[model samples]
Target: MRILQTDPDDARFAAWCGVWAASQRADRPDELPRPAREHVALGRRLVEPGGSMAGTHRAAVAGDAVVGALRLLLPVRDNTAVAYVDLAVHPDARRRGVGSALLEEAGRIAAAAGRTAMVAEVDEPVPDPPGRAFARHHGWTCDLQESRRDLALPVDEDRLSALETEARAAGEDYEVLTWRDRTPDALAEDRALLGRRMSTDAPSGDVPVEEEHWDVARIREDEAAHLARGRTVLTGGAVRDGRLVAYSELHVPLEEPERAHQGATLVLREHRGHRLGARVKVAVLRELAATLPQVRRISTYNAESNRPMVAVNEALGFRRSGGLSTWSRRI
Candidate 1:
């Protein structure tokens, strides 16, 4: 077997995408099978090297067939010590050393880039998933465990209204504002601040990550990347004393509006307990229902130890769907 760097534009990338899509479907029963073309779209949109995050895609090939694929992400600005990886091995080709070969290559790439640790996540429907066991066999430790939750959409209008009313009672002093695509210039700085806070304030549970660096430029860069990937970013923020103190965001794929991925939802340390978290989330969902009623589900993951946020999600009718765990090892 030989391993090669595969550019998204390379014809060989379709082979990698096939492996990725098949592996995802086989391992993650909760997720529907997305066409390899969607995977291609994701690969082609890798952020440029030297940006906040740089990435590379690698494929493991035996003769004419690809058996495994890996995407390595190196954060350039912060969390510089770790390389985040997403790896997949075709079910038909597992246990034949393809995964081990790709893993070694990934480590070499991370080391060459001066990284000291590696992190990867998996969808674990059960506690002892094969993926977790494989990580353990390789001396990696599961550092963060999160509960994956899903809220079926077309939420009952009455229940949503009641949630909004209750949240408003606690957040009466704050202003909730939302925007699509681009954040307004007046709130860019505050949004960036909140983004940085999300890195630190969120329950990390020993995950070897540091506060991510964020600024207006980084925010704009991310937005541009989202647009490049054909995604619509919906953001809602809570403003207090003319500055954003809390926020929530969602990314909806323009081509597939049936589901949306929830991003960060944060309330500044000083701004906690006001239900601003719920208020902002509710606002975003309200806008989603009004504008994108085709969206049938919203999915989010939260550190299992974060009961407060978990409670907020439950209150909004999100139910546990599966599990998400991050495993890491010193490179």
Candidate 2:
């Protein structure tokens, strides 16, 4: 078996998608498979190599068939000391050393880039999954466990409306604002500030996370990337004293309209007691339901220890779907 560095061009990209889809189908058939076009768009981003995020892709091949693939992401700005790795091996090729070969290459590449630690995540419906075992055998520690939840759409309209009414009353002093696609110019600065706060406020469990600084330019870059992937972004925020204090976002994929992904939902420390978290989340869910009626489910992941956010999600009718274990190893 030979491992080769691969570009995300037409042929290699197709092979990469095949490997990833096959692996996920075998391991987690209940989850939605990532859209191929989204993979291509992300490949373009990874290949550019000059932004806050950059990555290298490697493929493990046996003769003419690509059996496994690995991606190593290095943050160009904050968290420069760490690298993220994702590995996928086709089900047909597992236990034949394909995954091991790919991981070895990833570690070599990450270490060469001056990264001190390498992090990876494995989704497990139960503890001691194959992926977890593999990581453990390689001397990786499970540092964090994240709870994954999903809310089936067409939520009881009457109940949701009633809850929204209560939340609105609780946050009577704050005004709620909603927007789609892009952040409004008037609220961009406040939104940027909130984005920075999200990095520090959210629970990270035992996983090391650096606070990411955000500005208008970075916000625009993120918006552009989402647009390129043909995804719709819906945002809801609470404003007090003409300043944005809390926000929630939902992403609907054009390629897979039946599913949506929940982004960050954060309320400033000074603004927490007013039920703004629940208010903003409910507002955005309503907005998404109205604007993207085809979305049947929305999925989100929260740190297992984040009880407050977990309560908010539970109150919004989300049910536990699965869990992920974040693993790390020193290189």
Candidate 3:
């Protein structure tokens, strides 16, 4: 098999992107199938500095046809010693050496870039999915477990009202604020601080990563990238003493009107236990309901170990659909 660099705008890249969606549909029959346009947007190259890029792509071709794909996410600002991998072999090409060949090339690329480890997320459904087994058989350690939870939208108003009412009493000292797309100039710095904390504060089992470096400039760059990628971001933040203490973000792709994603919800450690997480998420849900009523489902992934946040999501009516195991191996 010949592995070649594929341009995002080219047909091969489109075919390569299809491999991921196709694999998911075949393996996770219970999950909703992603629209092809959404998959293409996901695979679009966002080559800004640091961890902003969707990832670099390599298409594995054999018999003059593409049968596998590889995405290597390199972190420049931090975690310079590792490469994040997203690989998929066409269902028809499985067991034909396509997966192995693509992974071999991935290691070479990571090593050439001076990275010492490769990390990947594999499906780990009940009874041990083939993908997770393959990772273990190839010497990758399952480092973390994240379950995908989905909430069917149009949240019951009475339930949301009660959640908000309870949260208000708990977070009475804080104020909730909402915005769309970009961070307000006054809260830009606050947003950056939370964004940086997200890297370290979130539960990251054995995954090797570091606190992400963030600043107002980087925040603007990220917002710009989102606009360029056709993604609409809705954010809700909690303010205490005129500074943000907690925040939640909702990401909706313009093309996929029916699908939405819950990006991150964080409360400063010192600010925890006040239901700020729930309060901010409730604010976001309200904004989503009012402005983007077309969104029918919101998907989120959380480490199984994060009980507090999981409790909040459960209270908000999210149910588990599937899970992913983070697999890592030293090169």
Candidate 4:
């Protein structure tokens, strides 16, 4: 098998890569299947510098056909020493040395770049047949566990009203804002204010990421496009003091009916301790219920250690859905 450093600019092959991912998704149980257009858009974003682009993606090709591929994404800057391995092996061609070849190439790329490690997220009940053996054979170690939760919507109106009332009593200083055609100027400033919190607060395991490596412009484009595609709703609540203290997103899957996923709900450091976060979250859920009542479930995941956020989610009625394992190994 020969490995090729594929060009991100090759439109025809890029389109093929998008199709390959969607086809692979067909076998995964939890994720909703994606349309070709959405996959293309996602692929474009992942390779774009300000977007989710990591190092390089290589394809394992035999003769004229592309059989397997590997995707490496740079999720954190300080962890520039590391890369997230988003793996894909065409269903028809698994076990033919495709996966092994791809992983070997990945290690070479990481080492050359001066990165110290590489990681991937795998589902649990691990020692179960396929993936467990594959990971072990590759020298990948499973280290962390994450819990997933799902919230049924149309949040009891009484519950929402009561929470809103309690929140207002705590401090009637922040208002939740969405990004419309004309997003408030304050929104941009709020992102800046909350930027530090994002770089430091999220559950990145042992990776130090500085704010500079984060592509703010890419974030804006992706968020805007995601909104346009009707995939996500982003809400930021800014304090009257001009600070964006808390933010959350309710992701509405485009292809699936009545299913939405939640992204990171961040509350700035200084803004903690007050019941503001709990209020902000419930308020967003309530608004989602009122506006997108068709949504059946909303889901989120938290590091098993994030007690504060988990407590808030539990209060908002999100229940455990599943768990994912974050495995890391030094090169």
Say which candidate scores most in TM-score.
Answer: 2
Pick the winner on lDDT between candidates 1 and 3: 1
Question: What lDDT tens digits, residue by residue, belong to model 1 across residues 35-117?
Answer: 56556656655656547877789999998999999999888889989999888899999988888888999999999999999
TM-scores vs. true structure, each candidate: 0.95, 0.96, 0.93, 0.80
Clashes (candidate 3): 0
Full candidate order by TM-score, most accurate first:
2, 1, 3, 4
Model 1 residue 71 CA deviation (Å) reads 1.0
After best superposition, candidate 4 residue 3: deviation in angstroms?
3.8
Worst 10 residues of 4 by lDDT: 206-215
RMSD of every candidate to native, in Å, equals: 1.6, 1.4, 2.1, 3.7
Error of 2 at 49 (Å): 5.9
Off by over 4 Å in 4: 1-31, 46-55, 61-67, 75-78, 124-133, 180-183, 207-219, 224-230, 255-257
Clash count list over all predictions: 0, 0, 0, 1
> How well is each residue in 237-282 modelled by candidate 2, as lDDT tens digits?
9999989899999998997889899999999998888889888888
lDDT of each: 0.88, 0.86, 0.85, 0.66
Best by lDDT: 1
Q: Give the TM-score of candidate 2.
A: 0.96
* Cα error, candidate 2, residue 326 (Å): 1.0
In terms of lDDT, the poorest run of 10 residues in model 1 is: 41-50
Cα displacement (angstroms), candidate 2, residue 290, comes to 0.9
lDDT of 3 by residue, 1-331 (tens): 7999885677787677677777777887766555555545555534643445435789999877788888888877678888999888878889877888888889998999899999998865564787886787788998898998899999999989999999999878899999999899999998899999999998999897778888998888778766766789999999999999899999988877688989989999989999999999999999999999999999899998899999999999999978878889999
